[model samples]
Target: MSSLTMMPMSLEEIAQAVQGRLVAGTAAANTPVATSAFTDSRQIVEGSVFIAIAGERVDGHDYVPHVGAQGAVAAIVDHEIADADVPQIVVEDTVLALGLLAKHNIERRRALGTPFTVVGITGSVGKTTTKDLMKALLSHMGSTVAPVGSFNNEIGLPLTSLKVNAETRFLVAEMGANHVGEIANLTSLVPPDIAVVLKVGVAHLGEFGSAERIAQAKSEIIHGLVPGGLSVLNANDEHVAAMSAFAPGDVMWFGLPNGDGGNPAITAQHVRCDELDHPSFTLKNGDGEHAEVTLGICGQHNVMNALAAASVAMRLGMSIDEVASALSDVTTISPHRMAVSTVNKQETSFTLIDDSFNANPDSMKAGLDGLLRWKAGSESQPFRIAVLGTMLELGPDEKDLHVGIGRYALEGGVDALLTVGSASDASLDALAGAMADGASLAGDASHVDWVHDIDEADRLVTRLAVEHPGAVVLLKGSHASGLSALAERWQALAAQ
Candidate 1:
């Protein structure tokens, strides 16, 4: 990882920025900060500032001594750290203080009078992928900073923003929220010059209560944009396209052609996926500029994500051809997002599509679509299996949503379906069973089964690998579903 480019500041100056009181090791108040702030004590570098956040399981204050020994110049704490070797900045809330410090860093970068663009992205789905694509596209122009994964929450967004400095040209700030006002709070730290709203779906419907409420929550990013900032929206999604009304400045649309004579400002024409499910299309702009884009990544769903990233890069002076070339160079994104690999078990190799980083109704169907698109190399008859986990936070219709996925998978040509859940959580297990039942209703009951946990699921998959030598398996679920861990286990086994 590159060293953080945050400008150096005295410990006392940091204290004033976060509105904290400087205590302990007062003589070191004049010391210059050598690194940016960090929340994890293990990541602390010399002269770094540590923010001590109190969580339910563990309090960050417990690691203060450890960070001090690691040469952290100071620790920001909710209360005093009396016996610490380094200076302590006491504040009322460490998390809030961390956000304040990030805000201060952004303000400092702006004060240098250097060129910088902060692109904020938020939506129910596609935030991380879009962020990754934007980072790759923008890096071709100048230095770019973005989160590692889906680090778009309050804490993650601030930690990512603290990496920016005077020389950094682009900051792709991904904003995510489980409830209202979360993105608004994140935008206050680093208000974006270009805000991208990908799509409005029910990823966290249980928290927000309705799709309309989710749309309202997603619109906060547009509302939080800097004065005269640009808003990039998805034209295919009605909810997101409606957000254009809330933009203070201009709005740019990106999507597949609707075939009704209306075209998004940025769109994919003649889009089609190959035998491996990799999409190829002609990237077209409203100005009549076009480029052929055969994405190195899999999934037809990614076309809109590519268009969204291309919109921001083109807005920042990157030509259409440059954007297409950079986008094609990206072969993968953060792990478990339509990530394809060939794993060998007992000398029989099977294809694995690990889209298990997270899941919802929309993403689950997309994964199934990808699975249906896969074509076996030489096998006259290939079995396609889908290992799906529970989709949480779909409001009161959660069960119905799970059932819909199961029915859709089976009706859409999935050969085998396995729904996984933990035995400890009967409710989740029941939801898993509901999916199997839906599949049974759509097809054969013997073709569907619900497993109690990953261990049982693994046993079943291993047996299937033996019975069917060349099967394509897809693992799709939320993080709590443990399917990603299963994917990792199989991947590790393949390596050995």
Candidate 2:
């Protein structure tokens, strides 16, 4: 974790510029960057370039003492410093400087005409899952470098970029944005040769203020595309389809329905899944050839992730069969999302859907749709319930977004509901009030249940599972909801 190890090139080419400036420490051409470089002090290592920026919760500059003490080679700060002992690189903005340094670091690598190829992906949801799938596919083809998990932000993007070099074959990066500045900054750093917009929704409608603003922010991935680069999109996602007008290069799209009529650059046909709704299907292109793929994991939403990954693979010259074969067997990483969960003990098996990583209105509905379909298929399924928590960090549109999710639950066939937190109460109340009005709802209203907290909800889930014997339960919330703890409880019960 030594910052030096991550910035081998940056340190050597400093030319004493890094002593007080963000210049190369050495004269060697194409300097070797360290193992990995990062600006977040929370994930710091020796020789790391500590870019101190003022975030919403805390200012990294105040933590400069800790980062400097941790062996950071230099501190990139927005303020002019008087710390003579600290190698401080003064910049107008730490975030902006990180982007510049990262681009400079990559420019040296790109100059050699090496095998490196950058793949950038952006969307409202599924960015991480898509990145993971893309990495899995590309690694099978060559030496691949991808952002670790959800490290798709300003600091994370550049750190992921520095890992790419002359020998690297595929460089995959996940581009995420909260404000307009973030996407533009991250995009300029990697300058991807290809880009993918998985899909877009109202996930961050609060921050960007509107879905249109969110779409514009998500579309920034195309800004840094290498000339003549390819843009792969999810045609089913309205926000993504709008991107076709903004892309500067070739555009291709994938969809569940081929009716978009431009023959859907690629279409997943005869899609089928297990009772869990994990999809497996044949991907057909213009040639009418079919490649069968069985997604190891279950979830219709994830199937869309796979198809999004496949479209990029196709653009990379992978045969349809090769794409299918590559995705068919590889393990789909967890916490990305899925349809349902089954907790089986020595006697009884319980069904649960965990879409808890993070939720927005659209993904919430998708999760409900998948869970309800599973519940309906199993007629004897005891109780169909939704255990929901809050979706945080959503500035203003939180209430509306949460309400939209609740409406989907009522409409998507959730039999009973359990909500947590006041933010979540806003959603659950809407469902209850709407159902009270006798509006046509998903399932029996007599089964409706609401909990004020996780403990209360847990008690209900355990009781319902034990009594009903066969039920499909869904637990979804933001990162702070502690829904995973509930899943852990279910897992423990199943183990017993």
Candidate 3:
């Protein structure tokens, strides 16, 4: 919530530049721009533009009165709303207007001669992390702007485009998908000469309905790339591997241990992951160019994130040494997307792995992997745990996707499992059954640990901390479920 010394322009002036209209204003042409923007009415600030949008269940026109009170200088309505005189810049369609405005702004910015390098990234997993890596690597070389948080969706993507201007040298745009064609729409608004598609997984299965559909939805970014653009993909992910033929130009791949299924690119070795699995490794290309780089963040999965960013940077002419050196000063973002926070309600008694910021199958797996790494070689005797919440937005196939995470966590070495939320209830049962069956196979049936709620397990976690003295715990869930509250309470008990 910090303020920038940026000027504001009225909605009327923006309409004139874009060939839009002033529908109901006696002050149409007279209205000067206080600020330029493209968003629903709710985001309208003082002297700003309100893009009256229509989507899903609600129409933005329904909120024009509220926007006016919020100080929007003029309202841009597509179809007529029941308004008299708030100075409307009417358009054909507000959603399309949002993209066109963004597209237009990008063009104007480009004409300034120092067009920012637009690194467009989209996939099921690691888009945010990869975007963060790319942002860090680019900032090492020049001024960079990346989206703040999951600002990669419909509203977020257009909003991110507004941040691009004459001052921005690099803009790391993260694209996300839910249904088919979503990525394509966003990519067209800000085409990239260098596109990155990270790992694809069962992310929005609720919307896409199947993993194959999910993969197809993710592939939209490849097709939308600017001609002769480079495509950077995860060589390890089968979905990314399939995209080699679709890329318009050269395809560069990066992965762990360097798997060559007849195509060779770059590889990373001598990896040293911290308790969080944040990586510092030596990166060597098919050529002899080599350097040791460590991530500003941590995670076993983040190794790939760093590699993806490094690959794009190196191709764009950044030296390995510069990328490696700048990484040391970069920092990971928060809300337990593998963040280690100091905002403890308790003593610094336990580390909280908050994957609650966003969750899908792969992110859950990566978070669990980080937890295992943290628990490894620790002096804590009570063992590590996984607290899970429902991965919302996975429509009908939710049960199956939830089971996939449950199985991965059990196999990955989380000693105890704690599940919350109604969507994950079935996941809890399946995990208990899987653990029981595995225990039975080992000839021991009494050791499976499953808690019905976070409260029930809080005391046990406290005892684990007291007994072992240095217990590490993981708390992960979707943002909607407020799982961090449990993490805070658990940390409080451990502290006392």
Q: Best TM-score goes to which candidate?
A: 1
Best of the two (2, 3) by lDDT: 2
Residue range 128-192, candidate 2, lDDT tens digits: 88888888888777778787768888777877776665567787889998887677777767788
| Candidate lDDT values, in order | 0.89, 0.70, 0.69
Structural similarity to truth (TM-score) of each candidate:
0.98, 0.82, 0.83
Candidate 3 structure quality by residue, lDDT tens digits, 115-229:
5688888878778877877887887676777888768977787777776666777778889886798888888888887888888787777787777898888888888888888
Span of 10 residues, lowest total lDDT, candidate 1: 26-35
lDDT (Cα, 0-100) at 290 in candidate 3: 77
lDDT of 1 by residue, 159-234 (tens): 9988887778889999999989898899998899999999999899999999999999999999999999999999
Cα displacement (Å) at residue 90, model 3: 2.8
As a TM-score, model 3 comes out at: 0.83
Predicted structure 2: clash tally = 26
Off by over 4 Å in 1: 376-381
